[model samples]
Target: MSFSLTTDARETFIFAAKNVFRDYETTPPAPEPITGNTWDNVTGNEVKEAALALIRDGKDPAKDKSIQELLLRWQLSQSGIFPVLAAENENQTLINEFNAAVKGLEALTPAAEEDAQILANAASRLTIPNLGDSYSGSPRDAMLHAGARVADARLSKYAEAAGTLLYLRGIQVQGEHMTPNWFALAPLTFKDAHRHSLRSAGTASPWTLAHARINIEPAANIEEIQERINAYTTGKRAIERQVEAALPQWQNLPRDAYQDAITRAVNGETMRDARGGIVTWAN
Candidate 1:
């Protein structure tokens, strides 16, 4: 059977494309705001108050503890962690700190670097004919898949040493029980197979080609999604390697606790999903 991506799934795919071509934009940048709020103002005291409250009341260790301890249980659901915190909010300072904290955990190391290299070397020896680059359909699809596998292999190697596959350019995490997750460029509405790719693959086209350039709005969307996934994955893998290289240095940081941080940061879920142990994210 032919593989197809759903609207939700393809959203991530499109995001990856955008990241791939992030340096090349078709749109002109709007003039910078002469007077606009920053990440602090955007996030505001109100949200921080709420985030802190969750840490103090909902979490076991209150604000009196380390930032890592404070964030431990609250990382998931935003009920405590507050995913509503925007990067562009008026508080880029705090946002950057939080982002770094999350990235820091996924940046832990493991002992499988040599094994990964062996796998990558084996993959490099395998090749399939690429007749698709000359065409716009099956051949194109084949080429895309081949390129993705090569990239995935490289990422896998990084994860082998560090722990998590870096799906986003700046994001990283370990692999134990981690999902091969991807995010979309736009907020997605989950619908059934009636939506194009999920349904009639042979009869329907989610997008079209015109003037030798894909002439579908959905194409742009998919491209951006793909770009994000690739960027994040790359960064995530890099962090993973760093985690391995510096594992012994950060020994003061708890093992189970740190791993929990990785799960909360990467999957945005509970620590239970992170290697069957509970961990925390410092608020």
Candidate 2:
């Protein structure tokens, strides 16, 4: 079966595309003021307020539309631990500090505005792919799936290590169980994500491509997704080695987590359905 991403899902795909291309944009000498709707035009202080409100009084999607939308964009943007994780070499102390800072209410707000702007800039530079096209088990579709796996692997490794995954989970309110979507450019409405590869065959920088290759080596060949995943023993083993490697020494600062699910999914023990939901295999 094939599926085309919904509007929200397409935005999420674009988010991943931006994630890989955020560094290449040109901006004004002075940061331009953010412009948009009432929900969209909120300031840094307001974002912090919304964050607190989200933690203190979880916004209902219906009643608290404004703050909820703001919070959604912030979290969905490159805020919190994302910038750190998305850094070239993931850091340890930064991970430790981010795990610590999120507990307090003040430190994260200033960065929130900047990160949202970064996403804005990326969106301008990004040539959004044909997300409207249907995705089946084609090579392009596989590239998209493998890209999401790379995303999950990258996230699960560090986020799980720093204890931030479940820590963030504990803060969920209104019974909304957050998934990889909440963190990465992973799509929410659709059960999966789109990342750098889907944006363009050759647009991702060598660094980003190298990062993906380190975890899933065969993934370097976007066409490899067409083969049975189980046959990619080298890719699976590459992921294992990456999983077991020692943390890189502390970098100056940046960010901070997911793994088994991806390995199993990659090895064909589990898989995502057409809509991006998880589908387990009993055999």
Candidate 3:
């Protein structure tokens, strides 16, 4: 069956898409204003006040080299401007200190490497084959598609493992019987006669006469059984690869997408059998 999203589900997808876009566009807060004492225990405010004092004294603060350096350093710290330092130690000034603080703050900022791709994918409105036409052209379809795809892939793996366990006991036949012997029947006999005679023959047959019953009990050690199942499913390295590929998209999903995926998984709505057929759970 094709995947289709309901009206509410579509709205959820749009909301998540908008969030992804907003996160991408949102600028990180400017590095917290560097706070510390300047040269000789002078604070940023003190440096600013001293520069103002020079101006009040009918002197150019810019012409006073010491005052100029302090004022420049104070300005750099407050303006969020990273100062570049010269190679000579003799010229080492507040600019070097400010630059160091800036570098330190930069190191603390987390990289936004995944932002662009996440935003583009959320906005692309891409479609997946399973979701079908119902989700086409919908806002944030790309993220929905990604979530559904990953959920389906996980379900398929689970179904395969479960189906294997189901088949381990072998197929059960309700009634074993042989085909009608057309040659042995009278030439004018009707088809009904042939069938009746075959039934009689089957009944008299030794193989059919015997009744065999084989009762299989659940594993004595449930924990061991669970461990084995986990070994068969979660322990597979390939499953990890699938998880890694889908995780970024999954992480970017909105709450609705997360809920939808979990609901489908628990309800077996996303499971596929060994033959790649959908497996619906009983209500």
Q: Write down the TM-score of every candidate.
A: 0.18, 0.19, 0.16
Candidate 1 lDDT trough over 10 residues, lowest sum: 203-212
Better of 1 and 3 by lDDT: 3
Candidate 1 TM-score, true structure as reference:
0.18
lDDT of each: 0.32, 0.33, 0.34
Name model 1 segments beyond 4 Å from true. Answer: 1-182, 186-219, 248-255, 260-283
lDDT of 1 by residue, 89-117 (tens): 42443333333322332221111222233
Estimate, for each residue in 142-253, the C-alpha lDDT of model 3 and write its tens digit: 5555554443332222222222222232311112232221111111122222223332342111111111111111122223344433333332233333333434455765
> Over the full model, what C-alpha lDDT does candidate 3 score relative to the true structure?
0.34
- Comparing 1 and 3 by TM-score, which wins? 1
Q: Choose 2 or 3, whichever is better by TM-score.
A: 2
Ordered by TM-score, highest first, the candidates read 2, 1, 3
Candidate 2 per-residue C-alpha lDDT over 183-277 given as tens digits, one digit per residue, 9 for 90 to 100 = 22211111121233222221212123223322212121112222322233344345434433322321321232224433343344654433455
Ranking by lDDT: 3, 2, 1
lDDT of 3 at 119: 24
